[model samples]
Target: MIFTVQIKVMPLKDLLDPQGKAVMGGLQNLGLNNVSDVRIGKHIDLQIEAENREAAIATAEEAAKKLLANPVMEVYEITVS
Candidate 1:
């Protein structure tokens, strides 16, 4: 069966996100002060061939851990359907 997978990768909370911080600073400069702690993350959408949803999810998780994210500094989540 073919499944659709969505992956989200982001820096760990304890790590600094310079790009997100810069964007947040820009937002404040534009008078949008209500927003805080803005974080930047990556979204990946792909299709996979697997025997079942469980297998799809497992494959997606492996892909995320091995290539999509830096396990040491980033966290990843996967959704399969």
Candidate 2:
């Protein structure tokens, strides 16, 4: 069967996200002071053919680890539907 896989890739909390910070600064400039912080990340969707949800998640996780996300600086979450 085919599964819909979603992966969220984000910079580690301990690491600084320049893009997020830049956006935050822009927001502040626009008078959006209520927003205290921002974090930028990537959302990836994949259609995977697998026997089960678990297998689909595994495949998406491998894709996240190998190419989608940089493990040294980022973390990823995988969900299968």
Candidate 3:
């Protein structure tokens, strides 16, 4: 069977996000002061061929841990469907 996987990778909450901060600064310059605490992350989508949903989720998590995320400074969330 084929399953669709969606992975989101982002810096840990305790870490600083320079890119996000830059965007927030830009937004503020544009007169959008209501925006606060902006964050930037990566979204990965792929199709995996697995025996079941559990296997698919496991494979996706492994992929995220090994390649998609830094594991030390970054965290990741995976969803299989």
Candidate 4:
């Protein structure tokens, strides 16, 4: 069976996101004052071959941990369908 997987990778809350800050500053300069903050992240989509949803999720978890997300400064969430 094949599963569709979605992965969201983001900077840790306690960490400083320079890219996000830069975007926020740009937004403020553009007169978009209503937006208080901004954060940048990554979205990864994968087509995984597995026997079941659980198996697909596990594969995604390992991939996220090993390569996709940096555990020191980033966190990742995985969804399988």
TM-score per prediction, in order, is 0.94, 0.95, 0.95, 0.95
lDDT of each: 0.93, 0.91, 0.93, 0.94
- Superposition error at 59 for model 2 (Å): 0.6
Residue-level lDDT tens digits of model 2 in 1-81: 999988999999999999999999999999999996699999998899999988888888789888999999999998876
After superposition on all CA atoms, what RMSD does each candidate show versus the true structure? 0.9, 0.8, 0.8, 0.8
Predicted candidate 1 versus true structure: per-residue lDDT over 1-81, tens digit per residue: 999999999989999999999999999999999999999999999999999999999999889977999988899999875
In candidate 3, stretches whose alpha carbon ends up further than 4 angstroms from where it belongs are none
Residue-by-residue lDDT tens digits, candidate 4, 1-81:
999999999999999999999999999999999997699999999999999999999999999999999999999999875
Q: For model 4, name the residue pairs that clash.
A: none
- Rank by lDDT, descending? 4, 1, 3, 2
Q: What is the alpha-carbon lDDT for the whole of candidate 4?
A: 0.94
1-81 per-residue lDDT for model 3 (tens digits): 999999999989999999999999999999999999999999999999999999999999889977889988889998875
Q: How many residue pairs clash in each candidate?
A: 0, 0, 0, 0
Best by lDDT: 4
Model 2 global lDDT (CA atoms, 0 to 1): 0.91
